[model samples]
Target: MMAKKYSNKINKIRSFALALIFVGFIIMYAGIFFRGNPIVMLIFIILGMLSLVFSMVVYFWIGLLSTRAVVVNCPNCDKPTKILGRVDMCMHCREPLTLDPELEGKEFDEDYNKKSRQTKQT
Candidate 1:
């Protein structure tokens, strides 16, 4: 059996933001090839700028999430890490952690964090 793979929520979001920046830069660079067509070039440049702005928004959201994340000492890695929800993996070791006792021994699932699930339980 293959071992389950999980990434820290904050790390995942950070990587997504980094990827977005790269994509934005690439888009802007592609605009250089369209210099002969001023309209097309302008469109490319605007699109690239929008992508970059969206990435910035995502980065800001991560900052807010970090403030709400629960910091705990990872048992597997023996390092301090933050858990964002009921199920989150250790930043250093990828070990699944949970704050809810009922989910302590259960498999990790992102759906556990959904509002609909919580409502059903109640």
Candidate 2:
């Protein structure tokens, strides 16, 4: 099987936020073409603004998560990166990393983090 590409959670979310901004702008521009219908244009503009607001919220959330993320140097890439959960990818090299020693040298699996969280609640 081919190797699955994994992304750094923070970087992924940041990309999403960037995409949202572009989408919001596109939506707002679409509103301009609907100038004939004042109500439609108003709705589109409001929706666009809402999208931008949501993006800001997501960005803020990433900031909060960043405060909790663990910073470590990647063994494979020899670069600094942040690990958000028990398992996360290296931001610089996309190398799979784990905070748990037991998981070291094991295949990468996102479910490891989810399982850890579930066990904590039980």
Assess every candidate by TM-score. Answer: 0.91, 0.90
| Residue 76 of model 2, lDDT score | 91
Residues 6-117 of candidate 1 have per-residue lDDT tens digits of: 7888999999999999999899999999999999998988889999999999999999999989999998989999999788899988898988998888888878889898
Q: How far off is residue 63 in model 2, in Å?
A: 0.7
Error of 2 at 53 (Å): 0.4
lDDT of each prediction vs. the true structure?
Answer: 0.91, 0.91
Task: Score residue 103 of candidate 2 by CA lDDT.
Answer: 79
RMSD after Cα superposition, model 1: 1.7
Best by lDDT: 2
Judged by lDDT against the true structure, how good is candidate 1?
Answer: 0.91
Off by over 4 Å in 1: 1-4
In candidate 1, the residue pairs with backbone N, CA or C atoms under 3 Å apart (3 or more residues apart, or in different chains) clash, namely: none
